[model samples]
Target: MARTVRDANPDSRTARARLEPRGKPYFRNLEPGLHLGYRKAAKGAGKWVARHCTGEQAYEVETLATADDFSDPDGLAILSFRQAQERARERMVQRAHAAAGKTSPLTVRDALETYLDFLDANRKSGLDARHRAGAFIYPPLGEIEKLTTAKLDKWLTGLAKAPPRIRSKAGAEQRYRVIADDHELFRQQ
Candidate 1:
């Protein structure tokens, strides 16, 4: 078997202590721009947060596995420093690709979709209304690299003139909703 260099074990209390504010949060350099962080969220149940440098910025991502989960009932370590170190190394590599890009490309449609999902989850009854309110940002200025004042003006014009997507009446009698696209919305912001 191939021997490996080990970082602090995730299951060790000593390792967890080292991640606190007083102690050094980062340990053994698995590679440049990539390292482990002991993230304590609530009391002794926090997980590891991996900090990776990418696109001229550092991004911290949670590994989602708690140190307490691996420890024995009495809080004694379940694995040796060497064994836990090996496991942490493996997990770090697996998470690199997903968390590497801090400045990834994002479009207008993506933002709208995310917002729609949020509305559906948080404000269940308002999801449809929210979708209608946002449908105006399509057409000539459908997508852009972040919104500028000029793009927003164009969006306002489009909203006022764009025909409604749905005008049919259903069992409940669909009524027209006034999308909050008034110019005052911009002036106040």
Candidate 2:
């Protein structure tokens, strides 16, 4: 068990900062940003305490009634270390994104909804956006994660190459290999 001591600055570039655990009551498998030890409660016997912090200033902790290392508040044992690490990592990512004025782990639905929600009936281009979203966006790339540009491009290209919705129509659907919607071609002019 190694114990380190240091203070963290909240507004610092936390992802690039070191994750050395600073201070106290260290126990088995201790690592930076994770500390588990025993503490005496005011009214009862001593209990185990788990502390985890990202490179940011705030520390989040969990208390255990007994000496059990992996028990949750429900008294059943759970994998605490891995879960805490993941949580810390996610928090760091989210914080960085927030600081940069961007959203993190953007779901496919969220990005789509943003444009759809922002479409104003007053603007001339707003209806075009809504049209693009409905007629071109949803059918192919339905509920995928919007985390990466590569993913969006790949999805769009794949959708463009996929078989058409309506196999054949009254009009010249034969010229187009990947029509977004074949029904659009058949509309009575």
TM-score of each: 0.33, 0.35
- Candidate 1, residue 44: Cα displacement in angstroms equals 44
Q: What is candidate 2's lDDT per residue for 54-148, written digit by digit as tens?
A: 46777666653342232343333322334433444455556557766777466566677776666673456777777667656776665666446
Tens digit of lDDT per residue, candidate 1, span 1-189? 999965655446656665544333444444676666555444555554455555467555545344553454331333343444555566566655346542445667666666777878888756675546444454455477587889888778866776455565455544554546678974664
Where model 1 places Cα greater than 4 Å from the true spot, the runs are 1-97, 100-104, 130-134, 161-189
| Candidate 1 clashing pairs, residues 3+ apart or interchain | none
How far off is model 1, as Cα RMSD? 17.5
Error of 2 at 2 (Å): 28
Q: Candidate 2 — number of clashing residue pairs?
A: 1
Native-referenced Cα lDDT, model 2? 0.51
Worst 10 contiguous positions by lDDT, candidate 2: 9-18
